[model samples]
Target: MGIKESDIKQDAACTPGLSNFFLKDHPDENKWADCVHCGMCLESCPTYELTSQEQHSPRGRVHLIKSVAEGKITVNEQFMDPVFACLDCRACTTACPAGVDVGGLIEEARGQIRQAIPLTGLKGMVSKFFLKGLFPHQNRLNSLGSILRFYQKSGMQKVVRKTKLIKIMPQHLVDMEAIMPEVNKPVRKKYKNQNVIKSKGKTRNEVSFLTGCVMDVMFSDINEATINVLTRNGNDVIIPNKQTCCGALHVHAGDRETGRKLAKQNIEAFNDSDKVIVNAAGCGYALKEYPELFREDPEWHEKAEKFAAKVEDISKYLYDTGYEKPKTELNTRITYHDACHLAHGQGVRQEPRDILLDIPGVEMVHMPNSDRCCGSAGIYNITNPEMASAVLDSKMENVPEDVDMISMGNPGCMLQMAMGVQKHGRNQKIVHTIQLLDWAYQKEDGKEGL
Candidate 1:
């Protein structure tokens, strides 16, 4: 049923401390306390820009969350739609003058909603199969990747495409399949016997690498490139075997219990490592936010804070720690898209752009509203296709068509932007920022015939 004005008014009269959210990890009241109903975030919100609905706006959503805490609204379809529709891109938080954490509040509110009304039927089954059954387990992801590799290599993919059988699936999925990156053996599996990949020269730093679950499966090439770049620049990279998924997807999907479980596993997995290096922006941001998952537990929370402190995105890591600049010139005109998590979530805007600029013969074109959400907000394209498409459409308008390649940090953004390119009939190649650096180093090595 829809949230009625009278119902909200009636519930508002309830006791001050009472809450409609009965779950343990309900939305933190402190997050919304500073909102002040300011509309500063409205222009920054993609959904609000499209629908122009109050509930879809950041402050509006914050109001809804606050109302729930005040017993003015109950968790229902009325609450679920706006909350789930959110891209959680962290743009709103960036725009807020008061520095309100709309993303954190949305995630915590989702935790409450999931507990109050759990998913059932096909949606539940699929969600559970992927988030619970598949992600946290590395072997299963490898098996799935193997299957995909066979499909791509064994002529099944061509047959399905030629027969038009792929048209049976949703258009978005079909679009994604059309532009899907070739699946290869994960770096973790390739480097399983070897605990540490030694630096090319004298090692300057030793760091633990989180070869993320889906990242390793779908874009293992990028993972390989990241390691190559790290080692070439005098860093010995350590792959943590015990580490699994970073739990970003689970937390975004409102499965906080599973999110917490994965968080604990990762926290324990990388406990001994001094520095945790991540290539994927989503994974890095999720790793940094581990403390948020353990807010109620002091012991785990403290451990999580320490773990988070050591985590850094690969681009930022290389930039902060001086790396040898490639003498080889790439001569590639590339436009960089700021992955929302990398830019807004982690405040890592200039560091990556600076790294791109430092590359010899690489000309960087500025994408207008470069930090704008690309609608790939961690599988939002899969869940909310129409809005995602609209957001993608809006985002593509800002992408400079003149660039040879479109570079970004997150794999999800790469895939989503690939779809946008395909949908718009554009020819720009989608790539991770680290891949360009890797290519330059490879060229340098090739010139010397090393």
Candidate 2:
């Protein structure tokens, strides 16, 4: 269940002075060289805020990672607990004056940890099934979507709920199920026959879209909305058939080998496109970080860097390239929640807000600490339910009850915030930012009888 002794010896010979991390993708030393133990990041971290423990703080985690490199610690359960407990939200990096890449270090450290102590038993089985077997295959994900569609459409879901059969699972999962969005046909399948969805008017830009594995399956409506907004705004959208999962989830789960494999596939898939647009914050962030996965390989590393340069989040793309403002008005009061990857990770704080404000009659209410993590660091809610719930509860306190909707850029944040809304008995609707813009455009078209 661990790395072989021979493999460890080889890694040691290659990376001399390294004691615990016997892997090619060990945490980058340069990422943490700027850390002065400033304690500035302590206030930004969610775990530190909740636990009030130094070990849970950003500075503490950096120290621990440095300790592992210096032969002061080993990759034991004690070390694993704190590292895995982190939300990997990247808020701390925003707060750090030295700009330490804590999220990158955590991901790389996780890559090392999984090699040293591989998961076994039930956890291992589930991780392998989802991360390896399910995510990378588009056909498999589409099949899962079909199954989910049947479960939700058939009377089985209702019967199970009414019989209290769902209570057999844990409470957090039940909570997630309670607020689960209805599954629809993914946009990839919907537009499969058409290679290029041309613009309504004169073509302004040609961009390829990444219809993500989870994003397409779980929240395909948003994906469809994204295509509509783009086409309506004069961008010819391209959906590359060969594009696979962005590997954010795999990397987050410490499966760096699979992460690199997936990265290579996407880099090749979108090689010809001038712009690669992503609607999901996590997927966009992961796409931009493809270069990190190929640091050791120079040729692929250069390709990854070129690929990463073209990857842009949808909101930023629209804002930067000049999206048309909707003419019609649909009066709705909404507050914006910053998806951790969108706000802190990508520094996309203002672009989405700017997009929201451009829609006529949309009143923007401000949420305090809107950039705080909603505990949906990929599958963190499923893995660490208790902490995720506590973090969600803390996040809900800042949401304005007067708003009609909670708008954000990421699908994971939408689900997590939806659970928060349901749990707290609030009635605010959770929506992607692009959906609002699309709705406004549709309303305008409807009014003009288009």
The candidate that achieves the highest lDDT relative to the unseen native structure: 2
Candidate 2 per-residue lDDT, tens place, 1-450, comes to: 223444444564356445667658878889989999989999899999999998899999999998888777777677788899999999999999999999999999888888777899999999999999999999999999999899999988999899999999989899998998999999999999998999989999999999999899999989999999999889999999999999999999999999999999999999899999999999999999999999889999999999999999999999999999988887999999999999988899999998999888999999999999999999999999999999999999999999999999999999999999999999999999999998898888784311
Worst 10 residues of 1 by lDDT: 4-13
How many clashes show up per model? 0, 0
**lDDT value for model 2:** 0.91
Candidate 2 regions exceeding 4 Å error are 1-10, 13-17, 447-450
For each candidate in turn, the TM-score is 0.96, 0.97
Model 1 CA deviation exceeding 4 Å by range: 2-18, 447-450
lDDT of 1 by residue, 316-410 (tens): 99889988888888898999999999999999988778877877999999999999999999989999999999999999999999999999999
Residue 440 Cα positional deviation in candidate 2, in Å, after optimal superposition:
0.6
lDDT of each: 0.91, 0.91
Best by TM-score: 2
For model 2, give the RMSD to the true fold. Answer: 2.2
